[model samples]
Target: MATKVKRARKANFSDRECVKLLDIVDANIGKLTNNNNTLRANAGKKAVWKMAAQELSAMSLVQRDEEDCRKKWRVSSLIGPTVTL
Candidate 1:
């Protein structure tokens, strides 16, 4: 018998949550925005993201992990704010 695989729950960030996440990211921009390919730089980026997740979880009702925060940041940056004419 094959075991069923469980999928992770989706994260929906509110406007306030998004603002908080951006604030955290901005504070750690030096570490998070580095483009170095070295292992140390990659580790630093990971640490920063993890810290951001913790900060978000503490400030809000929703609990977010490092991967969740990372994915949300990517999607947010890509789509950005939409303006309707």
Candidate 2:
């Protein structure tokens, strides 16, 4: 019997990659950060995130998925107040 170890993927975002992500999120700002609580707005936000992830991965050296993009956005939100966008 053999035991296998799971490997962790590298998740460091380069400065250029972060800029690309910011650009994508900026392009979809309304849908991504809207405060409206309606179902249509919620669904649109999801679609926008998916599209953002696709766009980011297409241009980025690191292939980021939808969840990855979402996580990065959430992390970036902590500095939202300071950043002028």
Candidate 3:
């Protein structure tokens, strides 16, 4: 008899979660570009961010806030006005 094997399913991230993941990638990229030595010092983090960015791109979940401002504004319109303290 052949043995049965189960594969683990990948978790799906919501749009908000995707945004947070991209934020982490952007932060790591910023650190790498801010200084020459930072790239070497943060090699592990750089690799992690690079992989994350690629994954996000592949999933078509990465978006720029400025570029998607119109879409965002339209969505926010349904929320009514924001109150400032």
Candidate number of the best TM-score: 1
Error of 1 at 3 (Å): 11
Sorting all predicted structures by lDDT, with the top scorer first, yields 1, 2, 3
TM-score for each of the candidates: 0.76, 0.72, 0.35
- TM-score, candidate 2, is 0.72
For model 1, the stretches where C-alpha displacement exceeds 4 angstroms are 1-11, 82-85
TM match of model 1 to true structure: 0.76
Question: What are the clashing pairs of model 3?
Answer: none
For candidate 2, lDDT tens digit of each residue in 13-68? 66666777788787888887789979999899888778877877777667777788
Candidate 2 residue-wise lDDT at 25: 81
Residue pairs in candidate 2 whose N, alpha carbon or C atoms collide under 3 angstroms: none
> lDDT tens digits, residues 1-85, model 3?
9998989544444565446454554555555345556546667645655555455556564433322332333354467423222
What are the lDDT scores of the predictions, listed in order?
Answer: 0.82, 0.77, 0.49
Which stretches of model 3 miss by more than 4 angstroms? Answer: 32-85
Q: Residues 23-46, candidate 1, lDDT per residue (tens digit)?
A: 888788888888897999999999
TM-score-based ranking: 1, 2, 3
Which is superior by lDDT, 1 or 2? Answer: 1
Superposition error at 35 for model 3 (Å):
11
RMSD (CA, angstroms), candidate 3 = 13.0
